[model samples]
Target chain A: MDETILKTEEQDFIEEDICVAENLVYHKPKTLTDTDLHYCPGCGHGVVHRLLMEVVEEMNIQDKVIGVAPVGCAVFAYNYMDIDMQEAAHGRATAVATGIIRVLPDKLVFTYQGDGDLAAIGTAETIHTCNRGENILIVFINNAVYGMTSGQMAPTTLPGMVTTTSPFGRDVKTMGYPLKITDLVAQLPGTYYVTRQAVNNAGNVRKAKKAIQKAFQFLQQRKGTCFIEIVSNCPSNWKMTPVESNKFVEEVMIPNYPLGDLKVPKEEQK
Target chain B: MGELRLMKGNEALAEAAIRSGCDAYFGYPITPQSEVLEYLSREAFNRTGMIVLQAESEVASINMIYGAAGAGKRAMTSSSSPGISLMQEGISYIAAAELPCLIVNVSRGGPGLGTIQPSQGDYFQATKGGGHGDYKLIVLAPSSVQEMADFVRLGFDLADKYRNPVMILADGAIGQMMEKVELFEQLPRGGTYSKPWATTGKTKDRERNIITSLHIDPRQMEKINLRLQKKYKEIQEKEVRYETFKIEDADYILTAFGLGARICKKVVEIGREKGYKLGLIRPITLFPFPFKVYSEIAEKVKGILDVEMNAGQMVEDVKLSVNGKTRVEFYGRMGGIIPTPEEILEYFENKFLKGE
Candidate 1:
């Protein structure tokens, strides 16, 4: 074996080739536009949207997918997704998905919901749809605070967290504790996969993409309800900058709500 | 061609739905209307792939209907008094979206969770807007099991014809009573029944479509309202259906619908036997309200007797259609108490015969 040393020009060429190969291999999704997004400057919805579009393109299911948009900040998500999309009433996306799937069984169905939509007024629809074993994917964004409604306390707001509705720091005696939707849905036998991931760092973002991919695969297999709850950060609602919001998510939200798979199929474990 | 069978009105409605190529049904179990859910549940998954779901609540069931209708498939739901109230929001959404679906309201006593018995209390709710917004459901009032089956088919056709919701405003009496009905065969699926505007899936040939009612611009909303009104006008002119009784040279015309219409038939016979010049006008389509027939009768007859099971709801419609040309009198019984034919004849005897 002969050891070879690379020249400076060769090293530069290798770096340039790596960059070109990366562009060819992991191309950006065409579903998104370069125009400025409507989200706040440091909002996590943009990241989630990009990740979802990448999954849609990678799976090559864009033509056959239908997204049920929610009523909050993501109400206009239909404008971004290239697939067929429907906007549902504030908390009735699951019900709408049930209708669509029952009619068009071969198409992929997914819903993007915030914590308030999934855990509050739409609790019955969300829980019952999962219990009924509807073959659909649910991407629940748990930001611990309501962003669209001007910084109100969401159902996932932790104790001691302050919000418009919880000015006294979410009094446990009066406001009750935060809701754990992933854990609650994990108990149902109809749910095939249930996981919680965050988006505060690159490692967690990679983990979130994997979780989303698995959820979509589960749906493709006609397995039951696959739910991926992302503990997103709302820097605008938290009254912090982007970096500070990521730090708060890493330091505070993860401790109160630990991240990991709460439920998974036994056969897939090994 | 089929065999004649004795079936309850609710059961007949369920069978009619299956026969009319209804692919999906979402409903919650409620009193006086549970037979519909039961029958659909038993037969929905058998021959063709019919989706019958017992939703968590009436609200969820109607939203499911909204979803199914949005996909451009034949869908339906059924409920009674209190449950129909819960479905108002979803109904409004369905109407606003302009999706073709069927809804059945088996009326009972109301104002709240009233008793589950026969009453004509939901006339205003069905013919007028049950839900919010300026919308109309093509209201068909079926008096018997035969009409119940017939109207289900007619309701679906009219819904698709006008691209709007159609309702079969039956009552607890019609829902519970059994009658002989000739059942029709199921229409073959995937024939000529695909909606191009439905949210099936994105295809390269067409741009993405959205089914929504939110128009922020005042002028655009007005244009949409104008188009909807034009559709309603066309429906009114083309889809008016009714049954006429002996009204030539008659002095009084009795008008009613659903079970009340059946009772009015008997009242006509009793009044004829009693030598009273009383005819009958049975409205099959309640929203259209048989106005032309009423206008003719208003010119020919001396007065009109508007009979119902509730405290005078359809009387308002009768009066409006008559347009003050003829005197319209109302006789009603509330809280699930049905009016007997003799009671109505007696009312005619006292209020019209002796008073005249």
Candidate 2:
């Protein structure tokens, strides 16, 4: 040894060893394409997409599952998810999913929609598709704002939350209260399973993934409309960093949208 | 073997849809066309495993059609005038997305729910691209119960061929009237055409396809519009269908479609009996509007009578086709009232032949 400080290849050796060990702990879901996500860094959409792909890959139903993409932030979901996808008109994901399910009843059909796409313009479609008991999975992302259209007030936006359209904070007296669409949909007899969840932390992320998995499982049983409402975060629209947005979801958003199972089959009820 | 049975135009069209191997029918009940949904709901599922849904409203029905059509299934919806108006927005989206589907407008009178009786007021809405944007539907104006049944299969074929929505523009009279219809044999499922672009599901062999009308880039959107325009041009050149009666050595011509053509045909016979030298041109496809035939007739005939059930809606197209080369006159009945052949002949004799 020359006694001069020499950088060793030990760092590379250690990294390789750790990666081999980590292989048992974590791996990218194969259903997710290699393309990098286009979602904002702090956005919850990426996490939701990953959870969905993970479920898809783990279930080994990639070829049989068809997804309907809504016309919001998740519009480009087809680019990242390796499954077949149909892009629906604004608020028409449930309708589109109903179509796919009807024509290919053997296939697993799911719709990924935003709050605006579900509770606003597509309200009739959402309500009727559920009422009709279409055996499909609906993953509704309630971010309290229209993330794709740049912070416009959504039907799920908090009563007092400030948005671009409600710059002075939402006035419930004039603008009407935020819609409890999950609760409303749960009342429909056609809906067999309904849940409201959040993905703010690792533990919550695991729970949200479970809920989505349950929804798909119910659809497989042809139990009827399986709806999973995920109250997520839009960090950029909320004017916060990813860390702060996660914190906000815990403190402020959770109070407005509590996470739990809203409805289930009588036998599975808890 | 195919069977011939007496059927209401609406029911015949519904039967024809099932025989055409239509995958789905999503609709709401509306007068003059409720038989379509009622018949399909009662029979389509048991007969062919077709999906028939009674949607919440016309808006929901049309959106459901958009969804099914996007999945590369043959879907259809039917409504009267008011319901059809509610469907225009969804129809426009379907058109923009380039999804193939069938829409039957068993038209009643309208400006706003005017009447539940027969009227051809939706002629402008149909041939002019009812919803919005620079778009067109392959509008087939069915004048008889036979045509109503025949056009269902024809509409689906044309829609599949062009990847565009097709409209069977029937009126209340034709939709409600019962006549003998020769039903076609059921075509094999998946028929003669294949949808390579449909969003059925993704297989490993091909990249995932997205059915969308959204192209943020203006240039890209313009290219889509241009593509649709070129397709429409091809349709115009190849699918311009019309029937000419007694055009041999005629001095006056009558142009009409749907119920209007039925009345005009009678008027043509009446005029010819009176030795006024009259003929009729019934444009079967309202969109590809027989303009070439009209242009040719404009030079040979001295005048043309445009008859319609509304306040002279199709007359504008008639004028455009004639281009002031020969005199074109209009005679119309309004608000759910059907024009009589005698009145139409009187209007024609007084307006165009006599130059009154």
Task: Assess each model's interface with DockQ, reporting 2 decimals per model.
Answer: 0.60, 0.64
Candidate 1 local lDDT, residue A14:
75
* Per-residue lDDT over A52-142 for candidate 2, one digit per residue giving the tens place of the 0 to 100 score: 9999888877877889889899998988898878778788788778777877888889999999999999998899888988999989999
What is the DockQ score of candidate 2, to 2 decimals?
A: 0.64
Residue-level lDDT tens digits of model 1 in A1-270? 333445766788977877775477566697665556778887889889889989988888877788888878887787777777777888888998999898888888998999998898789999999999899999999999988888999999999999999998999899988999789999998899999999889899999999989988888889999999998899898999999999999999999889999998887898
The 0-to-1 C-alpha lDDT of every candidate, in the order given, reads: 0.87, 0.88
User: Which ranges of candidate 1 are over 4 A from the true structure?
Assistant: A1-28, A33-36, B352-356
Model 2 CA deviation exceeding 4 Å by range = A1-8, A21-24, A267-270
lDDT of 1 at B253: 93
- The CAPRI classification for model 1 reads as medium
Q: Model 1, B1-356: lDDT tens per residue?
A: 68699999999999888888888999999999999999989986796778899999998899889888888888999999899999998888888889999999988888798899888889999888988888888999989999889998888888887779999999988999999999988875422455888888778788776777766679999998888888888888888888878877688999988888888989988888888877888888888777889887898887899899988998887888899998888898999898899999989888765655
> For this target, which candidate reaches the highest TM-score against the unseen true structure?
2
Q: Which residue pairs in candidate 1 have backbone atoms (N, alpha carbon, C) closer than 3 angstroms, thus clashing?
A: none
